[model samples]
Target: MKLLLWLLLFVLCWPLALLALLLWPLLWLLSLPFRLIGISVEAVFALLRALLLLPARLLGHRGS
Candidate 1:
């Protein structure tokens, strides 16, 4: 789906499309740290949730 949109852009605006092609890797590199931070944040939230639920789990609470 994203490829189709990029192909359409390539047909309609070659220069912009070419620029996007060139910048793709740089954009991905720039985003890598943000992705890692997001993963860390998600893991922290999951740990908090598990810690919050631990007592209930130990008491044999069933999640449905």
Candidate 2:
């Protein structure tokens, strides 16, 4: 519903929509580095968690 209103506004004010379209790619490009850093940080944390759990997993497998 909100999207429909926005589209209506865009139709009524085309220049605003055009400006938003032009800036979208630039904004995404600027944010790409931060996104990459976030992904790397998440991966590092996942690896650390797996390392921490390895001993427990091995013990469980031996018992089974």
Candidate 3:
């Protein structure tokens, strides 16, 4: 009885498992460029913010 139940579960899930396997690579390829662009934009914003703050920080310094 347990063996039969296991077989039924396996049969039901097999298609879903195969679908995920097939789609994994395609999804990864599609998202690759978007991920890289997001990272690049984040880096540029951080650099710009740092540059903008540098002058304020230097001007606020007291020459004691």
Predicted model with the maximum lDDT: 1
Comparison by TM-score, 1 against 2, better one = 1
Model 1 weakest 10-residue run by lDDT:
9-18
Considering lDDT, where higher is better, how would the candidates rank from best to worst?
1, 3, 2
Q: List TM-scores for all candidates, in order.
A: 0.80, 0.71, 0.69
Report the Cα lDDT for residue 1, model 3. Answer: 100
**Sliding window of 10 residues with minimal summed lDDT for model 2:** 55-64
* lDDT of candidates 1 onward, in order: 0.95, 0.91, 0.93
Query: After superposing candidate 1, which stretches have Cα over 4 Å from the reference?
Result: 1-12
The list of candidate 2 runs beyond 4 A from truth reads 1-12, 61-64
lDDT of 1 by residue, 1-64 (tens): 9999998877989888789999999999999999999999999999999999999999999866
Clashes of each: 0, 0, 0
Tens-place lDDT per residue, model 3, 1-64, is 9999999999999999999999999999999999999999999998998898888778895433
RMSD of each: 6.8, 5.6, 4.6
What would you estimate as the lDDT of candidate 2? 0.91
Pairs that collide, model 2: none
Candidate 2: residue 22 lDDT (0-100): 99
